[model samples]
Target: MEERARTEEEEMTLEEAFVRLDGMVERLETRGIPLEESFQIYKEGMELLKKCNDKIDTVEKKMLQVNKSGEYSEF
Candidate 1:
């Protein structure tokens, strides 16, 4: 059988992840929600934080490993 299309949640991109993280921070700062809801928001924020940080770390690591003496390197 053919594979089904994945929804936005399943296909979240790095940009979308950052957007969510920003919104989470805004809500936490606003302090309009109840304590229980804030806790849930905090949990999700942490997960997003990890994901964003992981993505950045991965990119940085890849850049560091790139040989500066390779053909693409300047003289």
Candidate 2:
């Protein structure tokens, strides 16, 4: 069950994660948000950030592999 949940999160594209993070930031910046809600948003934003970082790391590794092979191919 946990693995499935992780797979679902990983299925979100990096771009989509960025958009969600941006929206979370906007919500966090808005005035009069309840403290509990703000905390929830912060937690979700952190998760999205982790997802973005994971995607970036994967891409970087792929690029490195391609470079090592001295070949250019679509990622």
Best by TM-score: 2
Q: Candidate 1: lDDT of 49?
A: 73
Give lDDT tens digits, candidate 2, residues 1-75. 978867867898888788888899999999999999999999978987988898898787677335567877655
lDDT of each: 0.70, 0.84
51 Cα displacement, candidate 1 (Å):
0.9
Candidate 1 lDDT, 1-75, residue by residue in tens: 113322443357788888888898899888568899889999878866776787777766666343656534221
- Candidate 1: where is the Cα deviation over 4 Å? 1-11, 64-75
TM for candidate 1 is: 0.63
Error of 1 at 67 (Å): 5.8
lDDT for model 2, please.
0.84
Q: Count the clashes in each prediction.
A: 0, 0
Report the poorest 10 consecutive residues by lDDT, candidate 1: 1-10
Best model number under lDDT: 2
